[model samples]
Target chain A: MRYELYYWPTIQGRGEYVRLALEEAEADYIDVARCRNGESKMMAMMNSRRLDTPPFAPPFLKTNKQIIAQVANILFYLGARHNLAPKPEAARLWVHQLQLTIADFVVEIHDTHHPLGSGLYYEDQKPAAKRRSEEFWDSRVPKFIGYFEGLIGHNKGHYVTGRRLTYVDLSLLQIVEGLRYAFPKRMKRFERKAPAIITLHDRVAARPNIRAYLESDRRIPFNEDGIFRHYSALDE
Target chain B: MRYELYYWPTIQGRGEYVRLALEEAEADYIDVARCRNGESKMMAMMNSRRLDTPPFAPPFLKTNKQIIAQVANILFYLGARHNLAPKPEAARLWVHQLQLTIADFVVEIHDTHHPLGSGLYYEDQKPAAKRRSEEFWDSRVPKFIGYFEGLIGHNKGHYVTGRRLTYVDLSLLQIVEGLRYAFPKRMKRFERKAPAIITLHDRVAARPNIRAYLESDRRIPFNEDGIFRHYSALDE
Candidate 1:
């Protein structure tokens, strides 16, 4: 069945994680919010009381009459359905744990630009953002990258878990791309300690379906409006 | 089988979420870090490569050789094992989605006092925290509580799902308690808009196991060291 993926139309935000998983599996799905009048539909669905499971925000997936939100939760559902995750319950939980950790990293990245509030502008919080970004690069980025690097080392596999490509690998690719786009100089310095992570990112990019999606119009460009905004002042 | 939970020994931080779930289920588990010499064991396990899946942070659960991390991921596992979650896949995913949303709110709460960085002191980021906390109370608290309020209205359930207490309900209770402790004035003002959510919190607290646990010595007192820190300036 074709899936309906709801999210903001323009930004390769958290919604992009769900996109990568679906694209990798070559699954039939509509980028619902990207289509004409889709934003209105998304807003309506989010505000509607008719749905038993109303989403708090965008990047929700509608499949089989069930609406699932949260990037990791959506990926968890699609991963199982599309064979993107391991079969065993334990392994799937591990992959999901990785996804949750990645989710934490993503939130931290977003806060670098919007430290004051998501409701506020970057210009309004420039000072705080600068300070926050300093700490982000100084500690958080390395800590997270090092953790993933450790995971790769522990697995002794081509991917995070093993040879097979799990949804976490796809997310890792997104994180690398987003970071490189948002903090090019910082990532260049940080990449030194994450050779395995970089390799994993490249390997995921080389996958046929992912490559096609990246090159095709399906992929959205990184911009200021997205989670990983490129703000020169915020980056050291 | 008995479970081993590794987390920070002192604070009722993220670990409390896992603890609440275990307590509600009356599951056989050890708060590994709280036990004698448990902190050392937790640290060794965190640094050890012997385990197939090493956790990046605490609040991890070990059972039958599988180490699961991330508060939501661990709860998802335990919810299924202990029959704490709904039976159907769609319902369970919905429960997880709710938990992820709660996790986001918890992060926001943590940042209210530590917006600059986790490594930095709340005092170092006091000004930023004031700004962040303002936005939190002004927009986020209302948005989140209202969302849960709407969920309750939609489900027409005593709990988040319907007539049954799930892990999400236990977490909601924690959020209420934490928020009340962190932002007493703000929560007092905000409670007017969230009657349903407040009622749900009360119901969860009134649960036999949870009531016992909260009154027992096992429930750690809320303090500045935890995620929901009490700062008078942040509340206003």
Candidate 2:
């Protein structure tokens, strides 16, 4: 298993979902393109013509044969490999749907600070962000999180996939952590309303492999370049 | 063998993906929550979704006891049921990853006009949307379309999966049509650089079932409420 992941090295952005899955599965993979003098290698993967199906963007996972992109779809592919997804077709899709929901939520999270465009700086879009964030806080965030809360209520277990620890669970765990990191004051106000989600995050963090991974040096600390950036103006 | 789709009546929206598959497969199904006095029926479905797994929004499909939401997931789940997707695990994952990429691209299309928040009216966000459309035209649109061009260039045939008119093929066709509808001048410019993708779109639309669907009354026209809406301000 070649298992190469291409993503920005320094920030735990969307790419972190891919990283968490590989770590929890105990897969033999390297964050190969993130080392010293490795930016070109990452660019080369982006430029690779040998790949039959190249990824639209990273973080893409390449085994010797298959290259899968999109965090949810990567997990879907990897879930089959590592038994992180449920087997029956219906069960599998429920998991996939949950992951897509997470991606949608992540988009809203990013939009809270960059509603105008990704190409422009935050300062340039601050007014737009402020308006978007207010709407996001009042409506979108609770709806998205509440949807997850509903999933937990339905699943009859701590995980999204009903008694199974799937990648969506881990990713949700990360989202909760990232949200708290990004919006500490807001998250505190809603903690009681989203107890199941908070508990799920706590449970995922305490998992043996995940606990060790978070405690270890392998986990990249969240920073400004990532999705969950700290903007004091938007946080409130 | 039972399929029930939940979606809005007045708009095709993302629900069309599920509709196309069910039509092509000649499957036993009902477009539930869409009937005489459909608004009431739709609300009834939403109310009964007192379950945690209730769809975050409509365009959800139910097969027997299993409910699936998200356009891509529905296609994915149905692709296997109807043999539309590749059987090989890697190939299946590859197709799924492509679908999610298209999903991301679709959201970007919606954001072109609804850049601030989906909750806000288009008129309210028009100023910000003008800026959003500019970035999408100048940067994001070409990058996404270019990425697809690269993927098709990798394979022998025009389709993303090669020799198979998979859901991605249908989706790319819809996307091409949508982008063309939503951003004609920009896409006209984009088309000059992406002939292969344009050809793939042609092939997908030219498929026997797809052609019929395109000509049929069931194929709803793109409207202001749908993903592809024409606003002169959004166009270059």
DockQ for every prediction shown: 0.89, 0.71
lDDT of 2 by residue, A116-208 (tens): 889999999999998998898899988989878877887779686678799999999899889888888888898899999988999999988
Q: State the lDDT of candidate 1 residue by residue for B47-141, as single tens digits.
A: 88777788989989999769999999999998998878987898899999999999999999888899899989887888899988889988898
Please report, in order, the local distance difference test score of every candidate based on alpha carbons: 0.91, 0.83
| C-alpha RMSD of each candidate structure in angstroms | 1.0, 1.9
Off by over 4 Å in 1: none
Across A1-236, the per-residue lDDT of candidate 1 in tens digits comes to: 88999989999999999999999999999998889999999999987879888889989999877989999999999899898999788889999998999999999999999888899988899999999999999999989999989889988899998889999999999999999999998899888989999999999999999999999998999999999999888767
List TM-scores for all candidates, in order: 0.98, 0.94
lDDT of 2 by residue, B68-168 (tens): 78988888888887877988878888888888888888888889889889899999999999999999888997888888887788786767778777888
* Interface C-alpha RMSD per candidate, 1 decimal: 0.9, 1.6
